[model samples]
Target chain A: MRDIIVVAGKELREIVGAGGGRKGLVRELLFIGIFGLLFPLTQVEAWLSGGVPAAFALMVPLFLVGPHVADSFAGERERGTLETLLATRLPDRSIYFGKILAVCGYAWAVTLLIILASLLALNFGADVSGRGGSPTAGSGESEFFVYPAFVWVAWGVGSIASGLLLASIGTFVSLRSKTVRGAHQAMMIPLFVVILGGSFGIPALFRSLPPSTQERFTELLESMPAVSVVLWAVGGLFVIDLVLLGLGARLFRRDRLISD
Target chain B: MTLAVHTEGLSRRFDGVTALDGLNLAVPTGSIFGFLGPNGAGKTTTIRLLLGLLEPSSGNAVVLGRDVRRESQAIREQVGVLLDSDGLYERLTARQNLDFFARVARLSKGERDARIRALLEEIDLWDRRDDPVADFSRGMKQKLALARAFLHRPSLLFLDEPTAGLDTPAAVGLRSELVSLAREEGVTVFLTTHNLLEAERVCDRVAVIRQGKLLAEGPPEAIRGGGKRKLEVTATGIRPALVARLMNTPEVIGADVDSEGRLILALADGAETAPLIRLMVETGVEVSEARIAEASLEETFLALVDEDLNGRSRVESASGEHPR
Candidate 1:
């Protein structure tokens, strides 16, 4: 157990000190800048019905989770540090968890910065628009934007769990690949599939319903409990992540140290 | 007796081709045992198996009295390994690399700093301790590797082709350090190399392996003495009569004239050198020189490998003649 902590600490220090930490921060800043422009240009108020905060909340998962997940193991294997990591006396599970934790830490930091920037942008825009005085189309109605409390808690929990699941999957793929390009190429397939399913397939499935059926489906989605649904999805992903981590540990052969 | 490393019928095969075949090796504690073999002779495979990096197909290995497979973590904590390539993080400075490994090896903060300082000094890299390892030369990298291997002061060390690419001075320095480590610190070293001369210089005992089998194993002198012995005699004004007189000696098994007109004798008894010298001088043959031609370890190794190859072929040919 002591060895595990020592190894994990060393890995964490390497991730932070070896320029990955700085690069991740830079990436986070770039994400903020891009989203900062796109939010107002797309007139997020129209899309969200004066609920710009909810649109920003959805963007948080997309911007922070993908790069953090990809960089966790694929980046280490590219830098030849993976072999050095496996050489330590730490158990495989410890290394796996340590890497996951490091990725989650980076993702959380980035997400926090994004949330803060989004909130600042929204307030600054509102201030410039004369204290919400201009009566837009949906201005009189109460907007159901993601509240600050909900955004903080939900992003924190969802990013951590999602980052871990993706990191573990990335690690397992990295262990099986010899080159960084190969691992990254293999890892992107699943990400692409997820994006395709979320963007096109889900909306198409909803569109296939009749107008009456669609109204009923919308009512059902609105009535569903958010916490329970999020819990089920996050719990299922966490279980899958643990299994993949175990598989990664089993495949972490010491001989690959020399072969790499 | 406590053995630093012991293997019984250790075998490893890849895709039905055996890399190491039923190898049994025992390295005594505190002995610098040299594992000598040619290229593709399973030296690396044996080292990997002993270190638990490669799983043996048939047998087991015990390192420092712990099962290599079952207790690899325990064994690894007590053993230092230096493979052919220096496995290091190139982006990190020399001090950082050592300190990182030292911490993982569980050295305290103070111990880690002190050892890193001492090892940098020992390797003559104190001034460059803060420089990234990527800027270091091959020799300097090798020195750092040696330092890393001894960071935790492991009792047993496995070095695979440690000095293969080193210059003369660097090789000599590392060899001296290794010898001193075994003699002074009582650290048992398992070294594998193709350089017979280097092995002859530093190793107390060597095992010559070929085709995944042990051909000959002993001290250099014992192996050199085991092969056929030759005697050379130089004489001025030696006639046929002088040659006949030398041949009449019971110890002279056969005699031949060389291209230089000097007589060479094959001795049946190596212990009769004194009598032969006396006989040559007393016969008025003006004996200028008399010395036994000592066989070298290389010669012994070649002879053994050649013999084994010939034996295998003969067996194959004979088996072909059988009905089955």
Candidate 2:
């Protein structure tokens, strides 16, 4: 147990000390800040045109969480630190859990920033509209405010799981590859396939509906929610991460590194 | 009385090519055993097998009294290894690299600091201890690697080509340090090298390997002792008849006339030099100079390998198949 923590701590410190921590935090902050400034302008246009304000809420988590979770393992392997971590006496599960925790921590922190930025943007937009004598016309819809919370919860959970799954898969790919570029290229293929499939399936399911049916579908999509889908994705990815952790452990033979 | 490492018929195959073939070794405790082989002669393969990095395809390896494959982790804790290449984490500073491995090895904070300091000083790297290993010279990196291997003070150490890349002075320094380590700490060292002279300098016992088989195993002197002894005899105005007369002696195995027509005799017993000198003077050979030629380890090794190859070919021809 002590060995696991020692190894994990060392790995974490090395990752942080290697400049990944600072670079990632800065990139994430800048991305969120830019997106935050853009959100209110878009939201004001939506309000003036009388479209739903809640639709913009989903983009915040997607933009903030997506990049944070996606680059965790791929970046580490690219830096050549992954093999060094495995050479330690740490158990595979400890490494897997520790990395997942670190990535999730970053993801959650970014998500919180996005939420804060969006709220500030919404408040500023609302105040500007009130001063302009627009009278806050769409204030009756509490769902717009509530939807951001739901999106945060869903994105936070889904991104953590998806990030862990991708990190583990990336680690596995890195183990088989001779270089980081090779590993990154190998990981991108499967990620592209999964993203393409999700884009095609989810949108098509909502399209085949009458006007009344579309309204009912939108209500169901909001109220019934996709938390289960997020949960299922998280659960499936957690298992895959465990299995890949085992494989990465086995593939990390000391002789191979020494010989290389 | 204990054996630090023992292997019997250990063999390893990658795909279809044999890397190590039926190799056996026994290294006694408190001895520096040098493993000598040519390139691609399975030196690294043997070390990997003993370290439990590569499983033997046949037979077994028992290192520090534990089966290598079954108790690899337990054995790993007690064995330090330095491979030919730089295995240190290039991104981390020297201190960080040592500290990280020390933590993994379960050393206490105090012990870790002491060990790291001691090793860095011993390797003469204390001044550069805070620098990243990527900035280190090859010799410095090799020294750091040596320090890391000895960090745990393991009873058994496996060093593969430990001084392969060091300059002459650095190699000499490392050799002296290794010799002192064995004598003072009673550390059992298993070293593999193609440098025969280095092996002859530090090794108490050495095993010569070829094609993954032990060609010869003994002390350096014993291996070098089995070759023919040359006796260079200078006599003033010596004739063929006088040379023939001197060659008739029992101690003289054979005698030949040099280009200057001086007689050179091959002696079966180098110890018979005094008697041969007396006989030469008494026979009026007018002895001017006498010296017994010492056979070198390189010559002995070449002769042994040649004999082994020739014998194998003879056997192959008799059995109607080409030699492997």
**By lDDT, who's the top model here?**
1
- For residues A4-35, could you state the per-residue lDDT of candidate 1 as single tens digits? 56555555555554544356346456776666
- Give stretches of model 2 more than 4 Å off: A13-147, A154-156, A201-220, A225-260, B167-169, B231-290, B311-324
- Give the lDDT of residue B203 in candidate 1: 86
Q: Name the candidate that leads on DockQ.
A: 1
Candidate 1, position A143, lDDT:
32
Please give the TM-score that candidate 2 achieves against the real structure. 0.74
Summed over model 2, clashes come to 0
Winning model by TM-score: 1
lDDT tens per residue, model 2, A1-260: 56646545654554444444356356666757765556555765443331222223323333332332334444444545444344344554555556545544554455556555755666555544333232233565432322333344445565555555555555555546565456556766656655554567657766876779989867865676355544554577668767876776576555554344
